[model samples]
Target: MTAPVTASRGRVPASATAGRGPLGGASLPTWLAAAAAGMCAAAGWLRVLPGTRMALLLALAATAPLLLAAASRLLRRTASTRDTRPDGGPRPPTAPPPAPAPVSRSVPASTPVLMPVPLTLGLSLAVAAPVAAAGFWGSPARFAQAAAAAVDGWAHLLATTVPAGPAPLLATGPFLLVWVAAAITGELLARTTRAAWAVVTPAAVVFAASCALAGGTAYAVTAAAAFTLGGVLLLRARARDLRGPVPVATRPARVARVARAGAAAVAALAVAAVVVPHLPARPRVDPRDHVTVPDTPLTGVNPLDRVSPWLSTPDTELFRVTGDGPLPQRLALVALDAYDGRTWTSTARYRPAGSGVPHAPSGGRRLTVEVTVAGLGGVALPAVERPVRLDGPATLAVDPDTGLLLDTGGLAPGLRYTMTSLLPAPPQPADVDAAPRDPAPATALPPGVPAEIDALARTAIGGETRPGAQARLLAAHLWARVRNDPGSAPGHGYGRLAAVAATGVGGAEQIAALYAVAARGLGLPVRLIVGFTVPEGANGLVRSGDVAVWPQVRLGGLGWVSFGPTAQAAPGWQAAPAPTAAPLPSTPPRVVPGAGVPTPGDRLASDGPLPVRRPDWPLIALIAAAVLATAWLSPRVGRAVRRRRRRSRPVPADRIAAAFQEVVDTAARAGSPVAASATVRQALDRVDTAIDRRRPPDNDFAPRQADLHVLRELTERAVYGARPLTTAEADDAWARADRLRRRLRRPAPLRRRRP
Candidate 1:
């Protein structure tokens, strides 16, 4: 009773008769999948973007895919409409047949129209740019910088710790990541039937990346739910689109769809309940932790150098502290952990910090102190031994292991910040075995340390097997042996420390540095802490006179415990009185030869003075300069070598391409950078644009434009042409490229200036 249906190729077919659903328009589930990808990333970025901002951004991100999909659909329809002819061009019309012989005819499937890549990407940029500007820059003036950040902010984020604040620079990374994921996923789903295999798969990879970059907050349950819904919805939508519209679907097809949906729901429930929770058993290693911040010139003016100046300018107010809950008697600026026998420096790994610091292993009494800088300047923000939280306007960076805070925006006068820190308990006799030995700069013995210094350190510890007792005995020994001369010459080099150990006469600067070196020699982890001491009977005004350089030993369960070398100051030098309101329990001013603390009875022998070896000044200076020069030129040298190899490549075609790359690289170094992925012709065009922007009209300085044209043609031929290149042709290409490079390297003729 049914007429036979046949498929053929001729007249334009209707939507119901064509297989255009899957390859043409995006179904509802595809849209959901694209949207869910963005939400997954956004959910992870909750800490970076607050409630209202995050909601607004999410709305924009979700809407962008829809807008993009609509544009794509419209573009495809417009393109299809423009093609008026059939596959064989315009054909003559034929008369219809009788109704009794009613036959259904199907046309051969036509290739689905696709939105041009340029248009699709252009639309995506148009949609994402405004959101990036509004969300990250928030100001027209900063839009350009924000754009640059969008390109590379993710890299910067990798170097910073978690919750690295809501700064525009860091937030741009997450914003761009989510936006790009949505755009790509939307485009794929809209154009292809690979919903589960292709579209959702890419989104899942990006989701993993989002989770990695996101701060340490648990959103697994919510993200899992979104993934479940999105995956199921996307798959079902793709299946329906492949089968065409639901209302027209056959009874069997409808049953299949319902059955598939039910199965997917059940699977999702099972996985969500049983699988997601147990994934990734091992602790996740943060990518940010692997990133190291390069050393800057800040090391030159570190707090160690300020010791002498602060001591000399005794009465100058450094900062004033006002707080409750037993404020620390001492405040440290930085922990000096790296010693190179010449001088001690902190291997300060500064990264953008948030309000809360990750907790340290040891526990202590928590106290909150607020500080107002009077004359204290530079990057150091003095805080308690182990700061747990920082609340202030100043941008901060912290060393999580040491709990040392650094002010990225240099500390200036009147800068105020509140730091809540845990005051480590005073050194106890049982600490010898409790403290874990650090396997790094903390207890590392730097190269070139004089042998006598280690022997001297061993002498100070004196067969005390227990590390805590040994540390106490050593500190007490240093106090008894060394006289705290405030006017003593300042330096913590091996020579200075060795002399201090031998002569038994040193000020706080030498003693603290010497103690650190000695402890490292004894294999005990330590830090040379530089800060001001708060003395009793004095108000909160901490002066430069209170500058104390002391050593802190890491005990087993107690964090860094301050082991001061008790007072042995000269008669004339006395510590200023501090407020007795909230005395720091048990600990006292002992490192600076402060006049309050009692000296220990332990004293080590200094029977024979160790000879001080003067470092070779000129030789050392030359070596340092050479090392610096080498560091600067290494990259350039490596580039030259690479270019040489490229020019000498075995294949002539490769040589031609390499020649072009060398020129691009040189141009980029000169600040006119072209992307590595750009085609040769495109790169050359951009280079031309850069020159045109800068070149003056009627300027007599002529450039070889003809050479550039020939180079571009040769490069395009080498990369895309069918013909293989000859060695002679490759040589000639390199010759022209070298000329262009030299021309670029030469400073352009100075534009004649009129007085």
Candidate 2:
């Protein structure tokens, strides 16, 4: 009936299977997609500048599978491909295949799945790990540390800033992620059918991760163009293969279909281009923020509590500073910012200090000082603020938020280190009106703060609205009115602070604490610092005599600026700042000798509090959503596999039987299940009645009554008739069953009736 099928009717053979290996062959389109995916994933290394040698190694990792697949295809030719006549041109035609023998059972054994390299695929991926590891390490000799390097890379990436290093350990994370994804995608391309669609998934995951960690914004356009080209090529190739031989008469229709698909894809990309650029930019949610490190060495220890003890033992040398230039004016041991009615503690969050030294605000002179511990029994190290670098004898941890340093391994006696610090420029006379309040509510007193202290703070600040001016007025008022008696007992608690505020007489520790609490009342955020002030013409030695506590008020732009409340001649609103400021105010020139210049504002707005950072909660939510989606879709995946197995049977009798089973299953899922024990005719009757009851007469539910009846008759003949099922009858049955599956999958469930 159909004109004898041949290669010459402007029609190609469905498959030149004789030329393909038994396992299958990778389509040219799949190869392009896998390679493109590998290249995109490899680009992720740009974030941390993984070196040149690593790039060559990664290229090898990406290409190895392609090379191996090509070799396998070349070496293992099918026997049919070699068969030819003595003329050396072509093989002669053979007789048609004989009809299949009649089958007693309704179904035969299932055919093999489209992909056939389970064992080989595992071996391929196993080989991929070390290859990727070698690529990351950049040397064959260093493979031993590959696994450890992968783990270390996570910490290294999070601890160090962008463009961290070309270090081997740091390159492992991106290498393993890209290489493993590429290897898996390669396997899918090498031996599969429509499964080629899955080739993009693994590579896409790696590509997305790379995009997330990329250092610059240039990834979007270039990567999109590359991926789009590969994806289009793959779609075009697979569509051609799925269509098998194209008949001349159907060529125009096929072109129309392809044009529609291409148009749809282009439209989707156009809509995305139009929409994405206009969307609001969201903060990058780095899992790095959630990485946990060792707690600070002085976690709960309040350095302010040590103030009275140090002053009591005035001559005890805690540490010594020697330098290449002029010595530092003072060294701050600790800044205690959090007070919860009782104890004041530093917000010390220590992580391994990799490269970034946190923040160093403008206006500072660089100075290098070497500090060597002497009798500094406490864990806190005496160091300058805004340290740029440290080269030391101890393992150090630094708080990226506070620029606070800690010796994780313990600050033993005689421990030595050199530090680079930014010493702030002197305060200007006009600074009083320039600075604004940056009150950290966390530092202010809670509901438990006494009323009289709050009232005194208001009185001290008076009519001064400017933050810097209010701070100066408050400090001057304390120095003039409060009497510092060294004999005053050592508590700086709420009761002790209130006692000192009322009596106007207390040790320096109590006065400093009172200053902190009172400053909070004037709407100025404050913290207490315990440190030694270097005296004029001082030698290298720093003693407990210099251990005085002072209050620092945080201003909007200038950060924590220290005021000298203990200086005896600190006149009200007259003495503006520390000793290094311009010409002195109207007050007497009795400024404390060798008082430090204003400490540089190290805590930038970003470094102030974790709340200021947009929390990466959406990442956690995405993880949860992925888990739920996986659980929900798992059964669907299993059903798809089963459906493929049922639909792909090669034997005519088996195909007919599987077709009937599929129709019954589809009916069951659609809420009109037929009884398992029912006869073939009975099952068809029930299915027919259910379909008629649910589907509207004019609607698009496929397999009209006549087609379903014909499928039922064919199924009956395969299962119960004497003759073997024919290929024509089997095709008709499967076509109708698939149409039914489509019709049933839509539409919400109705009143479910049990079988």
Candidate 3:
């Protein structure tokens, strides 16, 4: 070998390749690295927003040809550079050897690098096919409307004439055909250029951003963070590659140090962002909002035994009675002998009979009562004294003083408790007593006792002589003469009883109280009964367990008769001749007083039916769990079935070789300068070598041989005579190969397989 080329210092020129950069040029790697970085960033972003990710993915899929074109451009550029000498002149070809057999290089693993574009485009189309079909056939108008709504500024630009009827071929048919054509073209370009990542990255980024925006801030933040982290990891990987080789010991130590530093930084940031702001002082909540004190007293461990007039309203319902038997004449809760301004307290401490239950009175007609109760404030079922017998399922106790049944456990809704109320028949006049000493507290006359009240009481009973008759006469007069006008008197005034008695007018409670005070003051054995009044036309009743106050006075040994002095004294009392007429020899018959017809007091006592029980939580939970399980399993099963089908069918060989050739040609066109004598396998091998040499092909010339395996196999079968090829098979092979070539020339990532 003659004289060797030498450098200026007299050293041989080594190999003319000594000063060349990796891959023979600087621009290709720079561009490819930039494109790869951009693609990585875009893919990261796509993971953040679902809708945007879907849309971009669809668009990328539709434009596969463009990606292939880019890959081909890259390959061509790369090849051109490789073919030229360092000084820029084309290298001289060596003389051909005589009688040489046709030779082909085996395909290399790296050939897939040039296939990104066409592969991405094909995948994009495959992915979007179903969506496109849905949009085309199933309510195209609705689909367009939804898309328009999702795209904020472009709504007006959207076409409104959706393919409605079937006859006009010009409508959806042509549009769909064009769309399919565009998609096919894009796929072909992608296969040829292998620049799939270039096409896919932007679409992915846009899609991710859109999804993030649509999902709201919480979702957006999480998505953005995840994408950012992925991008950082990619960057780190690229950086590591750029750093070149290092001593094994030093490399391990450096990697460990970096990892530790990164971990500490992450920990510190997490603590700062999430853990330090909730430790400040706060004000205490008010005690009144937490608890309520019980103002009424109880007996026999029943909370409902006590009745406070202050808390009682005239119309509040206490119970409801429903049965074939007549309703008990009077639903009495408790009897109070003493009165303060707001409440009635018993004058004497109760003395329980032998078993703590009040003993029945000696003689009286017994009446049965069935009661249902609701609400949560009480635990007692009220009834008159001397009940013959109690039935139904419920725990019963008695108030020692009032001799009323105190139901210990709160009444359940729809509960039916029975009681026999003993009503004494009207006693003979001779059997009645004149008067009895009062055991109750002395009445306290507040300032301004009305003069008329005393004079009226005196006038009505003065001539009667007998204490019992006098009490009855006075009650009858007041009930017949006074009007029950809530506004007839000045503000419920300071002297409540005195004022009401003087004016002969007041609210139901005030008037009732006056009647009680006046009757008791007359020396009759009178007791104040606090309970609700039943009104007319009340269809249903809700037993709130609330008690309303009224008065009950004894007529000698004849027993108590329940009546509302306030109601009788009201202005409308005489509008309808008393519900019953006085017994007269001349008159035939009249509605009996206090018989079948419900009084105003009774209506007030019954409101509406009560509920049975609380809702069941376990049944609801079980149903929810079943629904979730079904939802979770459906998609997985579908995917598995599809995968099985794909595995069962293998691709033909000629198609594989054809696809390989397409990728090689696309790469060459893209400036990657793959060897002409190289078979698809050889080209793949060269790509692998290039990658191992840390010189990735240009983005446009990225290989896609992995995706084109089926096409390559088919091509090999056709060329090597492994199998007979039909015209359709040849066409398919060419088409697939062409598509793969375009994809290899593009700058985007290869697309995923379609479902």
Candidate 4:
């Protein structure tokens, strides 16, 4: 006969177990982890500076869910305790009485996973929506605006290119999604022992790699370290929550063991991260010229057409020239004879400038400009207006109508050519008027000519009939009406000039185009030429900033004469660059410029061919020495780390298990290869097997065998049996395990697997 059971010595009431959910009481860690993930993701918003307001908003968005979870946890804990006592006071202890009969109370099983899936998803969506809305809608107040307009605005936000402005505000949506997904996945995986890697591994790799690729080196290293620390904390917390049902008396050892293992793994990963940057790069053939030169089509849209886009890169080396005589301030890429008010194109049929040398006035000096295509490439070679010679390995044709050079096959990087042009000699005023009348094609105006442009031209010229004087008057008008701004380049020359006339501001290119259009309106054969300008005093290095566009007028005797509409230089003969640096070496190696961003070295290394780089033997030797040293010390360092981390556990039994497990893992990493699923007995057997295979001396192995047996028995009892291990017993076990590990280390070389 059994007495009625009492709660004191029996199974706990059902209420104690009712709190279980799919996350299994792991809400605290889950929310914290989610917040951490969100913040890390937000750090990649854009390369630009995000102000203090944006940073605060990002922090609040990430932390809101965590704070809610914490508040809810506190409320539930308070509610649970409310039923235990009247004023939440602890129950008073009384004198011990005879123990009651043991009895069991039925507890309802935990809620099924099916319900929590939607709950978790709902919670995650609830958290993500506000963040997404903030990112898509920009400001919270904008929702009150027209619904249709708001929807269109949101669509536009999504379509915005990467690295767009408003920074963290634009990035919050993606960050929230990644965080919720990773945290939820981690929570689910946490239910199983050793399964946290399923979440941590992919997250770590993705975030770390993204930081490394998109951010600078310092940012990447910091991100990697932060990720490691966060992941370890999240994993440890989730693991602790899972062990909630285990007996408190025996839980410490297990927790400590897992904690030590996690620490060691993270330590090894962090060390590897630091070492990787120092490793010698693999040898490969160097990449040479692979320039993507923007083509100027037959329509004759000048380089000004690309100012809005192409001008972003100010350092790109376009070309390098070596000349027998003075180099011109500008080189014409192509000329347009037809203008439609907004743009220009050449409708005139291309004719050979000459079967041999093009005719130039008798008094001009013959000079040659040898150009190397350091970075430029296109169908047309940028040259002076009248090129009499095209000397290179390419077949080129000249458009006598416009004096534009065209290639049969497109030009490429490394292309070398020499252009011999008879430098322009100012003609006598009578000779210009006596020469053949300016061609009608050059002076023709587009349809619907703006009245204001014609009126302005007439007002500036003030009844001047001479073509040269008209050009000069128009140049003076352009310089006064339009201001030169190096920062802005207009896409449409004529439109830009019209705007400048009204707005009183324009870039050099726009001002030049204004003069061309106004001059043409007044019946002068004027056109726009786009090319580089050597500074008033230059050292032969032509930067992208040197590119300029200005007007040129065709006179009766003089070919196109540069009209200084923008005050780029004095109007005579477009003076040559003053000599500074010596000519480049005869033989230069092929230069591989930094991708997209041009460096100073993009300039020609030589006047001849590219130069070859010599290898650095000293750096190579230093790296090799470091590698050997790392290899020699690795095992010793690993052992010391393991020992220190193992002893970090406060519980005696836990310390013993941690020390033994460290050996098992180290042996596995060092090629013993024990599966996580292996039982204590099975793992010991593997250790014995590895020891036997490596060192097979029967008499000398007795002490190590004894230690191994003691460690195996003690660990099995500590982990699988109900008996609690005493402190003395735990210490003895640790000593034996440590001895066995030392013996394992002393044996023949262990092949370490790559991390």
Best by TM-score: 1
* TM-score of every prediction relative to native: 0.58, 0.53, 0.32, 0.41
- Per-residue lDDT of model 3, residues 1-755, tens digit only: 11111111122222222212222112233334333433333333222212343335433433332344445556654664465678988789978633211122232222333435456545544434444435444543344533333343122111111111121111222222223433443333223223333323443454353342223334344545554454454344333332222323233335654665476447544543442222222222322123332222444422213333323333445567654554443455555666544434444222211121222343455566576664423554556444545554424444433556554455666666666655544332233335333333344433443565567678767767675455545655655655555334332233765666665556555556666666655655555665433333343252332234565555422345344443322222332213421111111122233332112121111111111234344654554465467446644554344323322223433233333443453454444545333344445555443332332356623344443454545544544453566656656665655555444434532331110
Q: Supply the TM-score for candidate 3.
A: 0.32
lDDT of 2 by residue, 352-414 (tens): 554335443333577788888888765677777667666664256666555666777767778
Better of 1 and 3 by TM-score: 1
Compare the candidates by lDDT and give the number of the best one: 1
Writing each residue's lDDT as its tens digit, candidate 4 over 258-350 gives: 676666566666555655555443322211112222223463334556543334566677777677656655566766556777876555333
Candidate 4: C-alpha RMSD after superposition: 20.5
| Candidate order (lDDT) | 1, 2, 4, 3
Ranking by TM-score: 1, 2, 4, 3
Give the worst 10-residue stretch by lDDT in candidate 4.
597-606
Question: Which sections of candidate 2 miss by over 4 Å?
Answer: 1-33, 45-118, 128-174, 192-197, 210-283, 288-301, 305-335, 340-342, 356-395, 412-452, 463-491, 499-512, 521-755
The RMSD (Cα, Å) of candidate 2 is: 12.8
